[model samples]
Target chain A: MKILITLLASIFLFSGFALAETPEQKGLAIAKEDDKRDNGFQDFTANMVMLLKNRQGEESTRHIRNKTLEVEGDGDKSISIFDRPRDVKGTALLNFTHKVGTDDQWLYLPALKRVKRISSANKSGSFMGSEFAYEDVTSQEVEKYSYKWIRDEDYDGEKCFVFERYPVYKNSGYTRQVVWLDQKEYKILKIEFYDRKNASLKTLTQSKFKQYLDKYWYPEEMYMKNHQTGKSTLLTWTNYKFKNGLKDKDFNKNSLKRAR
Target chain B: MPFIKPHRAGWTLLFFLAILALFRFPVKVFAHEISGFAAGEARLFPNEALFPGQNDQSASFALQPEYYHEFESGSSFTFVPFLRVDSGDQERTHFDIRELTYLWLQEDYELRVGVRKVFWGTTEILHLVDIINQNDQVENIDTEDKLGQPMVNVSFYRDWGTIDVFMMPFFRERTFQGTGGRLRFATPIDDDRVQYESSAEEWHTDWAMRYSHTFGDLDIGLSQFIGTNREPTLLNGTDSNGSAIKIPRYEQIKQTSIDASYVVGEWLWKLESLYRTGQGNENYFAWTGGFEYTFTGVFDSAMDFGVVGEWMYDTREERATNAFENDIATGLRLAVNDAASTEALFGWVQDLDTSARFLFLEASRRFGDNWLLTAELRAFIHQPMEDLFFDLRDDEIMQMELAYYF
Candidate 1:
């Protein structure tokens, strides 16, 4: 009887230790769930307009065509081709994001008729003089960050799972990012970026959520406000198409010159 | 002859207008539209002309329009015409078919025909492997502008790499500044007295092949060319007026080049090397290697400071035609990632073997949405009499330009 009691007690203790979830585990689980829900979007194309606002309230607009392809077991591949602003017309940027390492990027200059591979060290730098950093424009993979569940909150009249994510890559400009994901659809509603000093720097909010193909949820509008600079950027997306049968050849370096 | 003489300029204007009208008509019928930019440049200096009958100031304007139409068969036709008008230098005024090509894209191969420009190199200060297009020297000395070349190009893309083959049917002569133009040699080049090593002269057929690939953090390109050399050898001759002049002699040559770039963090290492023969029955090698490091968000501002250092070398140091042998070029690039897209660059190239140096500064910024304002200054200092560009030692000039894009 004494031996049996000891064995039962040990089994109970081991099961308790295995089932109890820590904050880190809970955060990772939430992120994995969210990522799993967004799978099966093989490829997509969308048109976007970037509206930049200066400190004095002056505004400028840029039109771009964006295409993204999903890679199994890795980060997505993306390409952005500028169509408006005649000076920058025919310019294209191709990106290949990696799950655990730095992303690769290339920019094609039409005037020079060459493709230049750019360094990814300055991921924190502004992208095309906009509030969005180079890192922000990249597709976020689950392995890019380490997450910790903060608390549940109400955002825009919907229940959200609040989490703080620390970047896993080196030389990232932000110390941490606080994100609010809708509990039902696992859609990102808001994100707050903290600088390297852990000071609040910018806030990005998304609205007009739309479901495409009855499975993927995407926001039609995104706004980023720089609190310290009194500047902002608005990205409005339209003409979203999915599963267009885009092949791997469409996202390579050669495609940059032929993006138009 | 009288009717044509009276309407020469007007006819040119009408011809361009008619081309624009043709391009505009397709925009309404096709899904894609045509676009272009118009720019004007003015240059001034405080010193007298380096040569007699030259001006210390000049003005020029340029118009570049592009049109592309895609067909249902996945083939496309592209047309780009460039026209420049200069009030100071007659040779600088020219027209070019920058690109008039038909491109057919296949699953693993692509073919392009007609006139186009192709660039190949990794160095910032010197482009040793970029030989597909002829240099438009009358426009600028920077070698950034090119006159298009007519060729039939085929490119094969595979998992191994990309292989490109070019069949160039015609050779284009490099344009030179006239006697009345600024930055000219001691004597003008008599174009009429030009000679070619090939019996076919400008009709010589040239061929080239290139293989390029990118793996991980490194990009590499290897190319071979057998054709009329882009760099000409000056042969002393007498003009029709019985005055001594330099005649550009084009020679058939074989060249092999390699270019590579490696990116690590914020630093980029670039190298370009070439080996050429069949010029004056001599063989030589030239190379340029450099590194660029950028510091982002300098001084807590939204600015980037990039420093570049390049070393140029040639087997025939003093006798090199490019004048870049045994030289070092260092430059600074400043970028303010602001709404105006402001950028400034300062560069200095000094000959290691001679007391020759060149300094250049350029800054530009956009105004509103369509206008761009640019300022540039170029100065030469302490040039030896035997230096290639010594004749233009006193041609320090500052220029400003305003460009409107649509």
Candidate 2:
């Protein structure tokens, strides 16, 4: 009887340990692995462009000659130049994003001979009439949201970890977003946006990942689509350079006029 | 249909906006798409007429199409093609192209040339009756009704604010009633008399400039407008008293305005003033100021309230009417979960000159990111007077609108 009792207890203990390893736990582990592959991007810069199509079937293409200076523990500096249409040729946008505070921005208009600061917190607005919102340009800081591990799944034949995250910032555009992370690298594969009503409004897909500096995985292109409007925005990033030692003064309003 | 000669400014505005659109696209790809809406309303409140032509109703529609392309060098281009139709008991429902334009935006400046909308005046809150332009009021009017002049304009942004300047060579729209026109009266002066004559100019140019800035806690702005209104003169010797009078019908007008605002925490205060000059200008000056507060209640709900006042002065040698008006308004806006919100506003406008009053109410709500609705009701009331111009007994109007944005 003693032997039988001991055997039964051992069996129960083993089963308990087996049940503790849930799909969520497995997904989290996979996500950590992917994060390792994608992490350690200290600083980088790129230029981007977008083409917008209106419901009237009219198309407008916007050119952004952009430069970014990022740091691992400090902040990021960004400058954007509008390069098409002779009237707007000298327009420049500059931003100094802090690691723990509000970002400062300045736009330089050649016609106005001045720079304008964007003070309003209306980040949900379309970016220059494009499908992308103003918030889309901001860097995705992991600590800005609360996340929950959902499950481990195979996406596009690659292992992925699905996570639901809620924005903690007051000025965020959406209530919640579900993100898919590559299991091999912490790179974000896709994201689904849910509006205030909890209805899915849009989806973003990232692809064509390239490893730079032997440590950072970068997506060369991204696409976002509005489910209801059938409108779409494609972002193509090119001419990337890393660790340029950008200074805070470079993002000042005075620099806007010379952004080009 | 009688065709009013196209205003030279209108043609220029269309061309400008079209060119802007052209440069935004890839040179090899040129695509054009058309889209707009048509709305018709037949009045049934007072009484319905048996026949459509006899009904006290109006119907209008608009078609706005856009064209675009991409260039081999990765540049962009765009053009907007527009048309309009309006019909009513009055036979003004003729077909016309309301807008056609091109636009181009580059790194430092944006150039918009063509026959397109050239908008000015930077005021966030305007009385429903004060804004003569429908495009400025997003919640009201069809797309074509909100259209503006054909001109070339550009905007430059800096750290403090934005500076926008434009040269409009053509502007085609209805002019305000003055000089004892039939439309100037509140009621029909004669059964068969129309309020306006088709007026068009060959080629004229106007200049406007706007500057907006933020300094510390204050937001400041200034705008200037100088232009000419070229109306067809009465046919060779047609006079106001029934004699034919031929005089230069075209007139020149100018306007200048200054505005400022201050915001601290939940409290916001703003002020604006405008002055006008020139012949046949019917010069008018106006100023307004207001403040508002917002707070969150239990359960993390939000509410806002505010009040404002305004004054206006009319200066015309012929009319010789000086009027001062003050308005007090309060609004309640509420939100839940910071996702959905509803707002209701009430206002009272007091006419110190005539000792009259106008009351108004407006409400708006957002169901989600895609859907929004708004409604407004206004009533003009006062003691009877011998002026015999404005029937201040019981004049009321209501408007409602629904919108979906993508």
Model 1, stretches more than 4 Å misplaced? A1-15, B1-30
lDDT of 1 by residue, A1-260 (tens): 99999999999999998888777887899999999989999999999999999899999888899999999999899999988666888899999999988888888989888888888877888888889998898999889999999999998999999999999898888999999999999999999999989999999999999999998899999999999889999999999999999888888877777778
Q: What TM-score does each of the candidates earn?
A: 0.94, 0.53
User: Tens digits of per-residue lDDT for model 2 on B1-406?
Assistant: 3432244134445565455545534446443333233233222212333222233333434343434444432234444444434343222332334344334545555565654443232222442111112131111211224434566768676655778787876544432222221112232122122222224342556777887665755667687776653222222434467743334344555667777656554345656676765534356665655665444332322232334444433343224322233434344443331222356767665654565666667776654333446566665566336332243243254545554422
TM-score of 2: 0.53
- Chain A of model 1 scored by TM-score: 0.95
Q: Which one is best on DockQ?
A: 1
How far does residue B289 in candidate 2 sit from its true spot (Å)?
A: 2.7
* Candidate 1 chain A: 10-residue stretch with minimal lDDT: A251-260
Which clashing pairs does model 1 show? none
lDDT for A25 (candidate 1): 87
The most accurate candidate by lDDT is 1
lDDT tens per residue, model 1, B280-379: 7668999999998988778876688899999999997777888798999999999997888899999999999888999999999988888889999999
Cα-based lDDT for every prediction: 0.86, 0.52
- How good is the docking of model 2, by CAPRI class? incorrect
